[model samples]
Target chain A: MPVSVKNSQVVYDALKELGVGLISALPETWLVHLIRMADDDPDMILVRLAKEEEGVGVSMGAHLAGVKSAMLMQNHGFLASINGIVSGAQLFRIPLLMLISHRGHMGEADPWQTEGGMLTEHVLEALRIPFDHLDHPDTARHKIGEAQTLAHASDRPTALLLCRDLMWEAA
Target chain B: MRRLEALEAIYPRLSDCVVVTIMGAVAAELQSLGHRPGFFYLQHAMGLASSMGLGIALSRPDVPVVVLDGDGSLLMNLGGLTTMARYRPPNLTHLVFDNESLLSVGGFPTATSTGSDLAGVAAAAGIPYSVRVHELPTLTAEFDAALDADELRSIVAKTEAHYEPPAATSGFVTDLGLLENRFQFQRHLASL
Candidate 1:
């Protein structure tokens, strides 16, 4: 299935407004369009990572060097990066902005993704990482900017969860 | 060769490079040697020293960055090798101290002990320069050459496992916490 370029543009514009200079991501079906947009942008450095934890590491490093960076991945990848996020980003007080695709939500079709969907908010709460759910495309830019502000002010990782409704045109 | 011996030889040659040391003996020993604002001592992020160094190198192109990684830690994130190769940051040099064991966690043998060739893997992953050294002189010479060149380099130094003594308390102050250390390093970079 082809990605919705218009839907991806909403999130991409929000990222640019947030001034994210670098982005590290592990590709997911829902994030294909956004990832492609990031790769083509000359102002942004797009890093394709082998694992989600590496994205955390890269974002932390970029933060240390005064470059604002974000990590884009699925909720499953978010679970994979918990250790790195806690030890590296949280311990060092490095501010990282994460854009996670919210899968397995209420009407999720894939059984494999449902478990991760249900556990996403709980895990974020457990880690004490604040998050904003972007369920509507119109509010994405404002929510992303707010998340960036929170991340920088707290010197911690903050997340913007993109729901399938906001990411897919048909949905 | 022991890890400290290799460190001792290379310590004198370090200039204005930002050094990121992996957790465990590597971090403890580097802390014991000296405290520099340029040194980022990773406490518990086992496999991120190289990744962090890569970020610094990419963002700060004028500054040279070095990563002091252990074989165990490197093996945990072998994928990092490919990531480094892909970007091939000219200002970054990764040195893995291959003691073939997780010395900090009671000396359990790692993959390197079973004939895993990290330098070869790095070469195959597309890093421009990669070498393995087992002697102090060769290690120092190779490191010096890498430092002098403007290219991504990797060195796997075969080292023997040795216990790192705890930081002395009589006259030494305790190291800064992670947040403070990060701020201090950032301050140093800003000043530069």
Candidate 2:
């Protein structure tokens, strides 16, 4: 199934409304539209990351410069970025707004993504990062806004899981 | 050139630049000289200083962002080099102080000791200007040019593997805590 362009626009519009001037991301199946949206927007700065961990540092720098920024990646990418999240963002008290595509969930078709999908919530809990499920267009904007607010207020990492319900459309 | 001497020579030139230094000796030595609002000692997260500098440079194209990185840290996230090249922010200057050893954690040898060329890697990664310098004069000159020109540049300075013990720092712990440093830096950025 292809990702829903309508849902992608909802998320992208929400980020822009939230004043996110910069975003760092690694390409993922569910994030194709969002990455393209950011790339095509002249006002937005899209940093194509070599690795997800680099996004953590990018967010930190953005905060230091008073720029609102977000990081977009998949579950496995989030897993790869834990070290930077813990030591760089957490230790230094930088606000990180991460929009992670929740891959390998119940309807997952890929075997490789399953392990990371299963571990995603557990690791997020262990890291004490507050997160919300962006599973519906009705509440996604509110959740993302709240997450961004919490991240800046607490000066720590916050995540919004992009569930399949929000990203995918039935064929 | 030694790391401290290189830093000392360049410290005065950094008044207008936002400098991000990797943890341990580089951070300690820079802090020892003095703490400026534009200076950020990125501690604990080893290899991300370059990434941070790239972000800052992209965010604020008005000022130059200099990353004072080390060989070990640079090796840990060499992919950052590729990413930086991809963006190629004109306001960013990456300075890798290649001392050949991990002097912070018991003097372990890094790949640079065995001849891995960081500048070569950066050049191949597509940075417009990348060079390796083994002398203070050349390092300073390249740094000046990088700052003055509106182009993405990177300089890897070969230095002796030397460590400055904590005792030598005399109990200095960056007067401001981590959060305080961020707030101060943001304010400084606003002023600029």
Candidate with maximal lDDT: 2
lDDT of 1 by residue, B1-192 (tens): 988888888887554678888876776676777778888887787798888888888778888889999898888788988998999999899999999998877889998899999999999988999999999999999999999999999999999988657556222233566778889888776666
Model 1 sits at an interface RMSD, in angstroms, of 1.0
Best by DockQ: 2
Every candidate's chain B TM-score: 0.94, 0.94
lDDT of 1 at A47: 83
Instruction: Write the residue-wise lDDT of candidate 2 on B166-191 in tens digits.
Output: 44464335455777776788889889
Off by over 4 Å in 1: B166-174
Interface RMSD of each: 1.0, 0.9
Model 1 has an lDDT value of: 0.86
Error of 2 at B180 (Å): 2.7
RMSD of 1: 2.0
What shift in Å separates residue A2 of candidate 2 from its native position after superposition?
Answer: 1.5
Query: What is the lDDT, from 0 to 100, of the residue A17 in candidate 1?
Result: 80
Range of the 10 consecutive residues with the lowest summed lDDT in candidate 1 chain B: B166-175
